[model samples]
Target: MTIFKRGEKELALIELKNITKCYKIGQIQVNALNGVDLSIENGEFVSIMGPSGSGKSTLLNVIGCLDQPTTGTYKLGDNNVEKVSDWQLSDIRNQFIGFVFQSFHLLPGLTALENVELPLIYRGILGKERKKRAIEALESLDLGDRMHHLPTQLSGGQQQRVAIARAIVGKPSVLLADEPTGALDSKSSVNIMSVFQKLNQEMGITIVQVTHEETIAQYGHKIFRLFDGKIEKIEVLNESLKAIE
Candidate 1:
């Protein structure tokens, strides 16, 4: 329940100015994001809420370096996203951003430990170090004993935890999540949010997630509401309610 104000304690981990994303749908230009400006500093837990086709995912994609803004300046850490080549953008994504999704996206055959090790393998990390880091990530999420379980063998909550461990194994500066708890049961959703709270507060990871549910969104420090491709308002939650223990 800590809302971060941009008064210069730390440099912004993600910054966007006048961002616009346009897509041509059947010869009609559609703006997914319209002149959006945002700043997310290090260690902030922010949530984006909006109706369908309201640009929540678009903004997250821009922040995660998955897509470039049609017109805007986006600075993620030290890289200017618009100026980077596709190859460099790929490298930047690996270096500074970790992504979690509504779907766990675990390989059906790989064990949790091996799934978590995928990122490091992509980075060409040595095998021994890769396994060690993956183990540590899973253990941090209380999945140490489940390391050998395959995706189908684990429960939904356990599967999502595995996805999260895989996302953070490389220690990215920011974690971008799209409907992270959307597929879980209520109790499982609460567990996932608590895990996110721990990661944001204890590990100092900046987390930005898009969720449609208010109860889930309340876990964030500040909720940014979007409407028709523009940010409607910023709601600072009631801080007295502490993060779920």
Candidate 2:
């Protein structure tokens, strides 16, 4: 559990080489990714950005082990992602990655605490241990008071925080977020970014998020821009910006 330092050289937590993905839909073939090569070290916060159809989400999925590339070598930690069986991929996702979506994806019927415990429950963690971790996760996000409220009872930012808590309760190695702030207002978006920043800086968690907004993108250490299914360029944000309150 070594955190990657700025000046040190170590194996990346995620590596993608010559990645290409194709989707066939009713006699039409769509090439979503084209030879994208990327690497992300542990404890790094990176953002992916692109125009519509640029494969930003596709790339995130590949890194999260949700989708296999049509062609490529994807090394996540120590596993060859593209060659693993479906069950192994599921296990990998559960053990190594956590996901957050724009919609927050909370179950309406469950309380915030219940929703946060879902991932642990899926892994056969039950009763006291599961509840303990879930409470800690909520407390970590400063949502301890809202733990008993349902999704509909909480504010947008609160619900998202609950979703984030659920993602982190399992203590996954990497967090893949797709437009996590897309559904929030400016203030809430900034708040969510601050939460992510705290997690990356304090908890030594690796985060890769797909975002289209430049202001939001600046929150990350490096912003990868993609076009036509290829990464066009990378912009490194200044270190001082990480001090945003």
Q: Give me the candidate number with maximum lDDT.
A: 2
RMSD of each: 3.6, 2.2
List runs of model 1 lying over 4 Å from the truth: 1-8, 239-241
Candidate 1, residues 145-239, lDDT tens digits: the string is 99999999999999999999999999987889999999999999999999998888778888899999999998978899999888889898776
**Number of the predicted model whose TM-score against the real structure is largest:** 2
Which portions of model 2 show Cα errors greater than 4 Å? 1-9
User: CA lDDT, every prediction?
Assistant: 0.88, 0.89
lDDT of 2 by residue, 1-245 (tens): 23234323378878899999999999999999999999887778999999999999999988888899999898876567788899988988887789999999999999999999998988999789999999999999999999999999999999999999999999877888999999999999999999999888777788899999988989888999999999899888897555747
Residue pairs clashing in model 1 are none
Model 1, position 103: C-alpha lDDT score: 96
Worst 10 residues of 1 by lDDT: 1-10
Report the number of backbone clashes for model 1.
0
